[model samples]
Target: MSWPHVIPYANPIYFLWLAVALLPMIFMLLIKGKRWGWYQSLITLIFLYISFGGKYWQQGLALIGYVIFQTLLVWCYHHYRQQKNASGIFYLAVALAILPLTLVKVIPFVDGGAAAIFGFLGISYLTFKSVQMIMEMRDGTIKEYHPLRYIQFLLFFPTISSGPIDRYRRFEKDLLEPPTREVYAGLLNRGIWSIFLGFFYKFILGYYFGQVWLPLLNKSLMHQGFFSWSLILYMYCYSMYLFFDFAGYSLFAVGVSNLMGYDTPKNFNKPFISDNIKEFWNRWHMTLSFWFRDFIYMRLMFTLIKKKVFKSRIVASNVGYFALFMIMGVWHGLTWYYLLYGFYHASLICLTDAWLRFKKKHKKQLPSNKFTKALAIFLTFQAVCFSFLIFSGVLDQLFFHH
Candidate 1:
């Protein structure tokens, strides 16, 4: 069979190759307390080729162009920031950074549902990093931009395709400061365990849910109708599949990053057990949500508050949630389901905030107990599952197509 290496961490063979290539690097970290940069660079190129080479050569070219474009954009923005941090210039730089991603996201709808030529697998994540650097540069958090280190941070292969999306400052710190052997030993242990756990989650559990159960439930929905028991079953099953598949992938990404001496932030954190929608955001796809929080929601709220756009802070906060989720939804895709998914989550969070405020005002009147907490978890779980169903896009297919 041909190599199923087009996708990262999805195929067993890809991990096999990765493990072999990482052997020397792992040993070096364990023994010498330093990474061989040349060797690291070599493996990165090889893996990037494996992911973007041959049948995907167009993607490879696109990635190279994209990287160069972002590197230059960042460099220019850095230089501009040094001279003067014009809000207008900062906004323009941010816009330019995300322009490629915007085209990639919007092209399908505009171009008879065709993928953009410049779109690569990890384009969104890369754009996030680029925009982050620009933002930080505006804030003077990241004062300097070294093109090579920027490229290394942007293209770090382990978390490349789908990320735990490392921050440039955090990544650069690890790159500049190699871990001690003792520290690396712990990281190595965690890394290996995470990989094996990922295998179980993705190959076994994710396979069963996504490959077997999801397909069967989907077929059942087609025959049994949208309001049937099957749909309910499908919702929960699809949620499980999504969690295992994505969380498993995140585990693998984080695991591999640990091996390479970077403390990549985790994407998932027992999200299923979150007590409320706000708590869920904290626990789920954490990197992405946190990125949105820091870069999008926080910034927008700051702007609104600073400008006194809304009469009340509560009103401003609610408006911020809607804008944040709508933007996030649009980022996900131009589809109705994706938009609804974002809207639904934003609504949930806002309502949760209202409840929290009311509960706080009531103080001793509203009971705080195990039963209340469990009930909240249960209700929040159902709300989140429904949101995931919207995200699954099966409703659009089931209702619109059939």
Candidate 2:
């Protein structure tokens, strides 16, 4: 079968097709206060085919295998948890859920920098969802599993490629309960506005910053030394480009979900305005940060505390931060810069935590007015941008590769 393949929301043209495809569902939700499941499924398949079809068919096959693997894993775990729960089994289930993604991440490092056969875009996000399900199942929070609904949640095309990473329970709730007409109207309005904002961010600003000026800055920096003005400019420019590109994509995902009457979580919230590293993480990539906090950091802290591994809560928390960021860095890739990027953030967060504790102890003596807040924000922004410079892998290209 002949078909046009496009990455989700990669360009303006895709949005046109998206709008056309969504109109019928939009009407149905508005008029009936319910979704036409079969129709939604058909459109989802079409879009998935468009994204994973054509030259990307290998990734398509990989995705199918991944979905089946996760589905079966979760199913088995759910049944087992229902009968009886064991710590060993829960840990095994979580590990098995993450195994494919781990292989996909590790293979490139050992295989002469070749991509894994099983790797596909958004593998990390899907694995997160799968692992979350298994964990919740262990906790007895998720009592039942509907195979079809679970599949639909995984294949939800709007946020499939990259995500705001909707929670299973939240997504299931939306799936089961369509919004009322008044609420749907507000959602539609917000969705349209978000789409327009996404266009401005991704197409207009992102194109200028990333496609146009970034290369120019890089070319200039290449001829000059490391500490040149062009490099500094490139840092800020690249940071802006990264924010707009990722945030724009997130807005599109969220906007599309809203249009369909599902309230997926928001990803960004004035991240640049944050006064500290902790606040920045809270604002930027909100879903991912919260996921790491809930699934990794909190769990690790609990284990350490429960086992009496550390006497001090502060020390335990700091260790947890390091472990969490290191895993996150490795998740990004098994690369030097990515690893450094994770460590960099971990260090910043630890220092910020220390400062906050000190401030709390001496609240009366320490300044807490507008000037201090502005300075904190400025410092935090610069530190974050510097970390992004590392995350960009430009330093690796400049120093190591060259």
Candidate 3:
């Protein structure tokens, strides 16, 4: 038997089904001030089925196995962390947690563009959560292991595919305690507003910029060739398209989670208004950037400093930025463009750091003003748009495929 399938937030029609599925949960949360666990579980499974069932059954099977694998690994690590404080065991567990995702990412490159059998959408996000849990276990932050709850956190349909990446402990607390009536009323209001705003950003602006204007811009650019007026138009158009499309999806995830009384973290925060590349990262993809900062960069810096790997703190930090962004780039894909995009951002960030330091040293000489801040924002915006053009893979298409 065939089943209906839909990508989460892919179109307006999906929202109709989402509204139907979420209405009961929303009503219950509003009336009773508590969510029905079984009902929520049923909703999660139904959505999962819609997302990965039918022709995507293979992905569904992979998701099941992946969840079970991570759950068991986390359980074992939790037990070990309780009994022992060995770093090797913790590192091994973290590696094991990410191994499936690594294979999934690597397989397509080696197998002539064939996806890994164990691959599914959201594998990367799931791995991030699992690794986080294992790290917390190692640090004794996550004191106890509850397999069922852990699975629920991993399988939470909202923000599962792309994430604002909630911490396990935060999620657990929200799950255990529904918000107060007053708090829930505010949350419901915000949730409804976010959904409406998402429709405007996604269904309206995203469709106009991405589906409508992007193709026309691309066609114009092709005729005009590189470095033409059309190329400049394509750059800005693609950047806006990406922002609205992704920001819209994230708003939906957060809104839906809010309706269920879970306060999922917000992802975007007016990234284009940033004065520098460093600020842009803090605003854009806030969760992913913060994840790398917490899990990878911070830890790596600690290790380096502890071992005296670099005499200069500046050198150490610059190296850390490169490593962090490079890993992030490769995580996006194995493609050359993705790798270069990562390096490009890393370079910009490092340069921004250097400039900030120089300005600090020359405080009297370099005056800060509103006009300077505005200029900085404009320059940073252009730089970001160019990077997005690289990320769009248009260069690859223009050069390699042609």
Q: What is the C-alpha lDDT of each candidate?
A: 0.91, 0.91, 0.91
* Model 2 regions more than 4 Å off: 112-116
Put down candidate 3 lDDT per residue, 267-370, tens digits, no spaces.
99999999999999999989998999999999999999999999998999999999999999999998899999999999999999999999999999997999
Identify the runs in model 1 with alpha carbons over 4 angstroms from their true place: 1-5, 112-116
Question: What is the C-alpha lDDT profile of model 2 across 1-402, one tens digit per residue?
Answer: 466788899956688789899999899878888888888899999999989988888889999999999999899988888778989999999999999988887777678335546888888899999999888888778889988889998999999999989899999999989898888999999998888898888888999999999999988988885878988999999999999999999999999999999988999999999999999999999999999999999999999999999999999999999999999999898889999999999999999999999999999999899999999999999999999999999898789764
- State how far residue 23 of model 2 sits from its true place (Å): 0.7
Assess every candidate by TM-score: 0.98, 0.98, 0.97
C-alpha-based local distance difference test score of model 2: 0.91
lDDT of 2 at 142: 86
Alpha-carbon deviation at 305 in model 1, angstroms: 0.7
lDDT of 1 by residue, 1-402 (tens): 554446898677898898899999998998898999999999999999999988888889899999999999998988878888789999999999999998898787778435547798999999999999999998889988899999999999988888887889999999889899999999988888888888888889999999999999999899988879999999999999999999899999999988988788888889878889999999999999999999999999999999999989999999999999999999989899989999999999899999999989998998999999899899989999999999999999888997
What's the CA error at residue 377 for candidate 3, in Å? 0.4
Q: Any residue pairs clashing in model 3, and if so which? A: none
